[model samples]
Target: MALRVLLVHQSFPSQLIAVLEALERRDDVELAGIGMNPYARRGLRYRQYSPVPVAQTGDIVIDDLASKATLAAAAAAAARALSYDGFVPDVIVAHPGWGEALYLKDLFPRAKLVCYCEYYYLRSGGEVNFDPEFPPAPPEVLHRMRARNAITLASLEDADVCVAPTPWQKSTFPAMLHPKIEVFHEGVEVPPADNRATDRTASGGPSVSFVARHLEPHRGFHTFMRAVPRLLRADPSIQVSVIGSDRGGYGAPPSDGRTWKSVLLEELNGSIDETRVRFLGSVDRRRYLDALRHSDVHVYLTYPFVLSWSALETMGASKAMVVSDTAPVRDYFTDECAAVIDFFDSRALATRILSLLRNAKIRTSLGGHAREAFHDYELTRDHGRAAWERLVTSF
Candidate 1:
């Protein structure tokens, strides 16, 4: 008999695309999905549900709790509907951050539950309070952060297995849950050296880049922008590309009620070369790679939060980079692999970028080491399609 599996997320196959493709290829495993809007794959069945609307009062923490509860209720209804169609799964793997996993165990008591524990909020040793420039975390703010973990804790309570992507990410959860969590990453394929993006600098001059889903303080966009003027002043021919939207994310919004990009750019108005800096807001994969390839160096910085897949992709492409010296980055890079700098100090960031830009040998060496490291990371000690299969089948 085929082993039945159900994968759950707000959007089916968002981060689970790799896992979905892997399972769908197996001859002995039956696959299905439950999502707010699940995609129609060739062999995989999907169930979609409209999430229940949540009403808001003035209290954000209370509103968030209500939102999670309603989403859980809506998701549970979809799962129950799946069973009504005679498709009970043997196991369920879910991303629990948004509260989809809250009531799943009750729906399928016999089925094993695997919770993708992405990250647990923390008042310290995490994103909050890390940036001193941001508003101080008062008692209410800390309380609100803790309240948001209601779903995360409940999901893990009955989970048959818990998975976190990296050691640093896993460490962010409460110590009590540490014993049950498995450290595994959904890995990326490293493209061969010859297939990497070649020198296609649009201006045919030296270039650098910074990428993220949003240009905000959380990803060190402000600091990267601060370093730009110094870099441009030092080299007239250097061009820079900034990727992602002008939106803020994962951190507090700028108090000035404006986009961080605009705020930072206005601050740097006369000092930096506006014409040389290209803010490619939200690009496709081809353009992203082109921007990356045309660069002399890439800069990726983030808070002590979830590591971006962009960082992994950058490594696979073998781009020379200056990275934030944070735990999540240390998990994938070293001094031998990429340039590490203090996330706060723009002066240090500028110096590192200038040093790498000036030295072709070191940039080449860093890119080479980064590629080697990318090929040998947790995907070996931790994951791959085979690893995902092994974990799924074990349940």
Candidate 2:
């Protein structure tokens, strides 16, 4: 009989989509998926379940636990319905952060449970403390952050295996859990970016791009925006494409009820050449790739946290880059590979971007190197697709 697998995530079709699609192609594998939204694509389907609501209690920690437990309960109910339909899973792959995988083992004791261990939060070594500008995490907040690990910890104790995208991310978990964890990134696929074939430079001089999921402090939106004023003031021909939504992710939202983009724009006080800068919010993949195709250089910045998929995509696209010198980022590229700079230094960021923009020969050389380095992280390459396949089969 083919291996019966159940895929679980709060949002389906995320990192696991590659794995799911790969499994769907195999005659030896049978797959079903569970997510918050109803999802069906590429001849595969998933059952959606509403997150069961929980009444808000005054306690932050208790309310968090209660809410997750409710979600866990909902997931458990969905799995039970599947079991009733004679679809007992042999393996369960889940993103456990939302507590969806909490009771899968109870539903199918014989199944091997695999949890996507994206990031393990540490009050000191992780994101909260990495930015000095933010007020230090208070004892209560620190306690809450530590408590936030409860769901993952419980899932880990029950999980047969855990997968983290990077070695640094895997290292964040306790040393004891290291034995169960594997570093497996969902590979990105993009052609090497060479602006030579394009006639964009004739249309406009030295265009560059910036991308993030949400323009927030954690992704260094403010730093990148701060760098923009100088780039605009220095070069009259230079144009910039800033791609992403004006919301927050990972880090806390602004206390003053303004988006970070608005805050930065207000801070700049009309200093930048707004006419040259295009804020292309949440562009489609075609436009994103098109922007990359037309650009001379790309900039990516981030805190010492989970690596953004966009960063990997940028490297895979093989564009000349200005990247932040964070621990997670160092895993993919070096200073020799691209222009690496301090995350907080807006001046250096602008200077490096300006330098790469002016030099075509240097851009081509760095872009080629970036593409070569990207192979190990690509889906079709040896380490990427092969490694993911081997792991899924081994289970």
Give each model a TM-score.
0.95, 0.95
Q: Provide the global lDDT of candidate 1 against the true structure.
A: 0.84
* Candidate 2 ranges beyond 4 A from true positions: 42-45, 195-203, 377-383
Residue 269's lDDT in candidate 2: 95
lDDT of 2 by residue, 98-203 (tens): 7898998988999999888988888666787888878877776776666668888998899998888888889889999999998878776665556472225444
**What are the lDDT figures for the candidates, one per model?**
0.84, 0.81
- Estimate the lDDT of model 2: 0.81
* Reference-based TM-score, model 1: 0.95
Per-residue lDDT tens digits for candidate 1, residues 1-395, read 89999899997877676577778888998888988984798888788878767768978788878888888898899889888988898989999988888898898999999888888998778888898887778877777778778778989998988888888989988899999888878876553352233353667778898999989999999899999999988888889999998875877777878999888878887786779988889999888877877777899999888999888878877788899998789888899989999999999999998898888888888898888888778543125666677888886
